[model samples]
Target: MNKKLQFLVLGVVLILAILFFSVKWAFRPASKSVEKEKADFTMEASALAGEFEIDEQKANVMYLDKVIQVKGIIDNISDEKTVISVTLKDPESLSGVICSFDKSSLTITQLTPGEKITVKGICTGYLLDVVLSKCALVE
Candidate 1:
């Protein structure tokens, strides 16, 4: 084959390869639910918040991106359009562990403030509050 024709064919093959992988990645199946995954760490909600409050960098290394199960009294609950966030903390403390769930995944009608519950989620990080995402109530 001619050199020009060979180069054109190679370029088209590269483009097609890139497009194939892109589409495959874009349509990949969603990850398993947090409820189904095993927890990497489990502790009280106040203790988790205290860890972040004590030393954020150390806490991040130990907890960030890890699946955790935390038990505490519900301090607050908010139902946004697509997400439900439950704050767990001690009655006297200002900071808390904020656990977020997909609205469709949880039956929030059964949850209320001042109630004790266990939740499993992936710890994202800390601001004023320790944040957990993809959370589900643990029965």
Candidate 2:
């Protein structure tokens, strides 16, 4: 092939490789999701944004994306479908973890504004809006 064609092919290959790796990496479930075997860890929302948070390193770990149990006061039940958002209370502020529920996972027949509840979901990410994985309401 001509020199130009050779460089063009190399560029194309490099671009494709980067794209493939990025998508795969981005969608790959966090380590906690696969290795945890059972997501049973529990945390209160207050600890997450306040004393529990570091914002330096403890943000995006498998524990955050793995299906784990958390007990917190029901601050807000945002959606009625596959996604329910629950925030911490009092000192933590609602900006703690904006977890998303897997609509098919669980059902809450009696979720109240100030009720304490247990939830299980993966910790997805910790941004301005922290998020958990495919969440499920614990009975």
Candidate 3:
């Protein structure tokens, strides 16, 4: 093959290889459930929120993207189409921890405000409230 044709063929091959691997990684199966994975930190929801409120940078360094198991009373539960967001907080506190669960994995009908529950999830970060994503109820 001429040098120009050889270079073109090599570039096409590289592009195809890149696209193949990208698609494979994008559609890979989900990771293990938070319920099955061991939590890196376990604490009350109020305490987790307090940590973030006191020092957001420090809390982010310690808890961001880490698996945490938090126990607290359900302050509110909102069921969306794909996710069910459960807010856990002390009644008197303005800040709280929000745990989001996959709607298909949890049955929120039995859960109600004021009921205490434990949840395990990955801490995304803190906004006004500490956010936990990919959460699962800890029985």
What's the C-alpha lDDT at position 108 in model 1? 82
Scored by lDDT, the top model is: 3
* Cand. 1 TM to true fold: 0.79
Q: Candidate 3, overall lDDT?
A: 0.92
Candidate 2 lDDT over residue span 47-71, tens digit each = 6544335562654453554566667
What's the lDDT for residue 3 in model 1? 95
lDDT value, residue 84 of candidate 2: 58
TM-score list, all predictions: 0.79, 0.57, 0.79
Poorest lDDT segment (10 consecutive residues) of candidate 2: 30-39
- Where in model 2 is the C-alpha error above 4 Å? 1-37, 51-53, 80-82, 91-94
Model 1 agreement with the true structure over 70-125: per-residue lDDT tens digits: 99999999999889999999987769999999886787898989999999999999
How well does candidate 2 score on lDDT at residue 59? 48
Candidate 1 regions exceeding 4 Å error are: 1-27
Residue 26 miss distance in model 3 (angstroms): 8.1
In candidate 2, the residue pairs with backbone N, CA or C atoms under 3 Å apart (3 or more residues apart, or in different chains) clash, namely 64-123, 65-122, 65-123, 66-122, 82-103, 122-133
